[model samples]
Target: MTPIVRDFRPDDAEAVAAVRRAALPFMVTTPEGIAFEVDQASPAARYRLLVAEEDGEVTGTARVGLAHQSPTPGQAFVNAYVHPGHRGRGAGSLIVTTAEAYLAGEGAAQVYSWVLDEPHFRTFAERRGYRPSRPAHFLRLDLSNGELPPLEEPPAGYELRAAADFADDPRPLFEAEAECTADEPSDIAAELDDYEDWLADTWSHPDLDRDLTMVAVADGKVVAFSAARTDGHTRYASGMTGTLRTHRGRGLARLVKNHSLHRARAAGCTEAFTGNDADNGPMLAVNKWFGYDICATEVRHVRELG
Candidate 1:
């Protein structure tokens, strides 16, 4: 079967979402979410949503882009997914070839990607000259029947609020994100310098569940938060949980996450999912405290683009 690769169309959202869901079940995805990503992606990143089709059916998809948020220059990322039934058909290779060509043209020195922790998949990345760096695990919690830890009253001078409560003004949340990002462990450091861009891509994403995203406020300032993303079905994920540098070590991160999980459970979410680098001991401890179990693992791989 001959496969043709082309830019994605708005109507192709379902096929693209299907590809992502089938290839990566641990992550939450939706058609509307796909459209939102392509629509709001910053131009600096040069984001491209590509799909590989055989005859008239979409079988593979790739999200290729530069890391615009990263302070490091010329860093690129490409995450591709192919339907399980369509393996060994050259679709994956074609998508990677297309992504690398684009990234290389943009003067990217290195490209980062995540490959599942499987023998056959690792062999493929090694064959393509990619080296493993950091490993991350995806955790899942069965929330349907399990008894969640009871929410506690906020400590003095601290109040718990939903992310939606700040709709009128989210600059405080942005400030918290900026501070927390400074501590995240990543090869490329990110700087969240623009609030307008965050509004478009992060705050306004189709799947972001603001009502379930818990925020910690101190003296009317957003000091910590646990963002939530839902599939509008039964699955929920911790988008990002961060505490301002000054607020760290106060248990605010864990506090907001617990509040968010309870909100999600009350909102009919049956399962919770989150991912963290194996080296992030603090977050790993927090997730373990929440009763989340590691369900899947992936290793970040890097390769120099020719």
Candidate 2:
């Protein structure tokens, strides 16, 4: 029987999480995270989580959604994954086709997906009309063995604090995220103007580890931050680490990220992972400085739909 594609059911959480981890080990995802991603997505995102089942066993998953944060309309994305053991069963194609039709029906003019750098994966995406766009690198650090840079004292007038410090009001962190995200390189530029959306999508995310997310505050303002997310187990991932434009000259990005790494190590995290746009030299340099090694590469693939 052909695989069945359908909206994610509550019980599909673990299966979806398993598929994602197997397909992209560098990223962190959990059952709770999967549920939260679909349940808390903003309406403008037009988000949908789909699972492909064969013989009553879940074999693939895909997340389809509009790039609601992008300033450009009709820009959307779909990321699909099939278990290595289930690859030739048509689960991957069915999920991607379903996701694209849904996205195009929702008014998306262009759809983007990330294809693994491996030749087979690239060929599969190309066959589906997804031309290469940009590449990204996934870096890994063995927190259990590799030596992490020792935590350092903040420079004068600069202080380090966990994101938890902003529990009463995360407006400062929100402002910092908005400023840094706008400057980050991307195929689809994003503008974060909605604080409520950020609060719902980011600040409250199930995987966000507020206590381990270090922030660099200068003159009582958030100048830089390293957002941390964990799988509630051994995997710790850097959601993002960025410095404000005005504070670029300083080493705040490195400072906060190193501090967060120390926190993660102390919290029993055995592995740390982060991704960088292949063109993001500064961040790549920072990860290198932290002894991270490149583990995998993924290329952004785009398909223009008329």
Candidate 3:
């Protein structure tokens, strides 16, 4: 078994997506999305998707890059995944080593990754000098058969609309996203205040389903939104769901999310996934009301740089 790591090619999309699905079923990945990332990765991220080939067969992958989107300099992330059947071999460790070298070359001082809660996975990271930090949970909802809260009309003067309605101008959506993200509970806070950068990264992302993303508007002002990302097949994921600080207790987040999930179900998505920090009590409560169950837990681990 000769396993070698190499940079990803356009043809590796399907195989890459397959490996990700088997290793982490919680996140939805598509061939197009994989390709798009490789083509559009920011220069600062130094993003490279590496595949581990065992005797000409792609078995594992590593998404290695700087957290360029993050305001913190020298912060990098390496998410490595090896297929179940391919585990126990050196594929996973090799990918990690390869990614770390690349990030180090790219000027990443401190590396971070989300190690699965499983004993072996956690042990692997700890042995590599990475200490655990914040923890996040991955949740799933069976939209096909599970019960979902019925969608309701927003209060008078407040209405629900699809994100596509703002096709002509999405600056308002960016404004809302920036505000909500700044308020999120996270170990590494994100500041996404630039619209052009947001356009290049978020709104124009391959998986963003504008028609399915629900937004709550009050008096023509975009106040709350639930962005939906889908695989165009059977899986749906809530990319982000948030409400502006001005309208927190108005049930707007619930309203937009419920509508987005319903639309996803109608569009043939059977499984839905969302994640949250353990400290985000408000979001955990919201997800529970929507009938989502905890599927997997990932404890965020961080390591200091020399």
Candidate 4:
């Protein structure tokens, strides 16, 4: 059966999530999360979730969008995934072809995607003119059976709090996140200055478990945070973990993450996952100390739109 690509419909949420789970088991994917992403995307982003169907079954999916928050204009991205059982078909090729044309029409001059660091995946991207860039690793921890570090007390003048504590106002968390994100190592430079968008897209995300997210406050200010996303069952993933520049080297990142992991485990979460850029040694070391093992690696690939 020939596969055809089309824009994702609301009813395709579950199928899309299933495809993602089959292609990347380390990360958490939920139907509600998929719907939320499509519904909450900013207009500037031109976000489009594309699905490849064969005999009325969703066999592949791709997330196509412009880097709206990037300072550099004309930067775009498309990450495509084909179900393991459906590979070797033309679904991946068709999805990328459709996404590239759409992005080019949207005035994008460059596009980036993440290809799994496997010979077949690398060959597929290379055949399509995508050149390898930086690489990242997906790490997993067995929250149910692994030994997590004991929670430590925050330093003298610092205290730990739940993200839910800021229910009335989450601006402090946003401030810390913006600061940390701007410093993160990435192929695309993002400027996270829109608080309203952040509130809608992140703070209110369906998967964000405020109760499990731990924050480190110093001098009554949010200095570090470990954001947690859960599947409401057994899977928990670290959305982001960062410390303010002023608080670096103080072990605050570790402190908050440890607390969040313990909370997740107590809440019945059996597994935890996170990703880190290969260039980010500090974060990799931190995850290593927490007993996380590298489960998979993906290399970023980019191509000129001309």
- Looking at candidate 1, what is the lDDT of residue 226? 95
lDDT of 2 by residue, 197-289 (tens): 999999999899999999999889999999999998899999999999988968889999999999999999999999999999999999999
User: How should the candidates be ordered by lDDT, best one leading?
Assistant: 4, 2, 1, 3
Segments in model 4 whose C-alpha atoms lie over 4 Å from true places: none
lDDT of 3 by residue, 84-189 (tens): 8899889988998888888888888888898899999999999989899988999999988997898798988898899999999999999999999988987666
Among the numbered candidates, top TM-score falls to: 4
Give TM per candidate. 0.98, 0.99, 0.97, 0.99
lDDT of 2: 0.94
Per the 3 Å backbone cut-off, how many clashing residue pairs does candidate 2 have? 0
Most accurate candidate by lDDT:
4
Put down candidate 1 lDDT per residue, 1-306, tens digits, no spaces: 878889999999999999999999999899999999999999999999999999899999999999999988989998889999998899988999999999999989999999999997788888888999899999999899877777888788999999899999988888888888878888768999999999998999989998999999999899989999999989998899988877789998889999999888888999999999888999999999889999999999999977
Report how far off residue 107 is in candidate 1 (Å). Answer: 1.2
Better of 2 and 4 by TM-score: 4
Query: Model-by-model lDDT, in order?
Result: 0.91, 0.94, 0.90, 0.97
RMSD of each candidate relative to the true structure: 0.9, 0.7, 1.2, 0.5
Give the Cα-based TM-score of candidate 4 against the true structure: 0.99
